[model samples]
Target: MKANPISPTIPLDAEGVHHGHLRLPYSRDDSAWGSVMIPICIVRNGSGPTALLTGGNHGDEYEGPLALFDLARSLDARALSGTVIVVPAMNYPAFRVGTRTSPIDKNNMNRSFPGKSDGTVTQKIADYFHRELLPRADIVLDFHSGGKTLDFLPFCAGHLLPDKAQEAKVFAAVRAFGAPWSMQMTEIDAVGMYDTAAEEMGKVFVTTELGGGGTSRAETVRIARRGVDNLLKHAGILRGAPEILPTRWLEMPDGCFCFAEEDGMIETTVDLGEKVEAGSVVARIWPIGRTGSEPHEIKANISGILVARHFPGLVQSGDCASVVATMAD
Candidate 1:
């Protein structure tokens, strides 16, 4: 049996139409059974800087990948001045299994970046993207969602420190998302994630979390569509007034971590974007099957905007149960 090819290059037009595929190696055993090649679509215009749009790093996150598909179909190359590379699905194995990591390597693709040439499955794919795709591009827009287990409130996250100029560009691209809220993120190194890698490489990149709780929501699609349009408009690739929503972009202040004190069933008393007072109870966690049992109240650690709440009612100890964006004094 012939081994499968990896990094298959698919040619696309400005309208995002797929014309053909270019195969790239995924592993040493390219001719081995069940080996697979990742696919990328190149839409070249030769006028503007390359804008690379990627999705499906986390396979369970569907909206971003789907939105990229839509973008490839609708975008007009004649109007675009630069190259537009669309990797609709980055984690082929994860996507095949409908999970967050490569089933074969048991690795998260997002965490593995600037990968090695002679590395494992996930690392090799990351290496290919970094070497072949990233260097040629001036900007990158990485689409994402809450993953399989959580439904995130629509938002954007990127490094906010001024010294990281390319990171700042990533944030600006995210701001083009027009999400109701944009968060200046820190502690991203806590996990070796993709956006962090993008920052390290000095590439302008942004990751959008629209919605996810095992399925794609229409609202999520709508928000993602508007986000793509706005980003294109901001990049000067598209000529139109993309709708921008009233936004509340914030910075997470000191003592901002929301560590869960104990594990239990969470009951949120407020929604996303609500204001809360310091030491106020935002949610209560009850013991399993003890509805009337005395519940432990989860209080705000600092006074600020309630930017994100855990969508799943159940949580484990030390998990991020909530987030409060502290207001400036």
Candidate 2:
């Protein structure tokens, strides 16, 4: 089995502002010997905590990449107290094509963590992060949004980690980012996620779900930029206090979610951030072509705010229609 040929151009320990690439060798029909260079930027100053910021873990998501690209271009490396490694497009292939998974291997970068060095292109990229990047960082902020399939209210979130101390650190970072909502979340599955990998290593990890629908918004982008600055300050790598904002705390204790039972056209009555009660109808799925059949009502299992919902009109059986967030203590 051949190993991944991807390698970083910039030295991780190098000082000052430097723009480089993670060069991944490719053998395609157009250019057999050419390579795809995933852009990366590094800012370093003295001895301080390192922050690794990434966006575009799934190619369709744009807020992370947009915010990180600006930071890469605008931030001064000489003024920093520690290192900031910015990878705006973690899945460059998917990002280039505007899809959630890589076109080459159809692998989700977020689910390819602690990846195989001898695996597919997506896995290779994940392998590099797992082996070369994560070890050097004291904190990590991975940006995310709902992408094309769903929309989300702007929020910074942390998982319900087992390690009390690490969980506390992650919570602090989440609050520090200061979005309108702060989520203490539990995923349906965290087996191979990048978040799982980071949390497992006890790194202070924070992620965000800004506005979604496969595009960037002025407000979400602004939140991303402000959150990054706040995170750096909170980590003591930059000078200044974290920007204070009133954040509503939300939680998903058991990953309770609403799913469609039949394939049809969905009409969601509630919007993101709207409050709902348990057993209440959140959405109705109607017949796509025929109008005689009764619409199936999708109901919430618990009372909470509507944090995310399906964006597309059409849906398949078992597709997640909505997710609710309860107020957290």
Point to the candidate with the largest lDDT: 2
lDDT of 2 by residue, 74-144 (tens): 99866678999999999999999999999989999989998988888898899889888998899999999
Alpha-carbon lDDT, every model: 0.71, 0.90
State in Å the error of residue 326, model 2: 0.5
Q: Which digits, one per residue and each the tens of the lDDT, describe model 1 over residues 55-142?
A: 8898888887788878777777676666778777888778777888888789889888766667777877777777667777677788
Worst 10 residues of 2 by lDDT: 1-10
RMSD of each: 4.2, 1.3
Cα TM-score of candidate 1 = 0.84
What's the number of clashes in each of the models?
14, 0
Q: Model 1, poorest ten-residue lDDT window?
A: 1-10
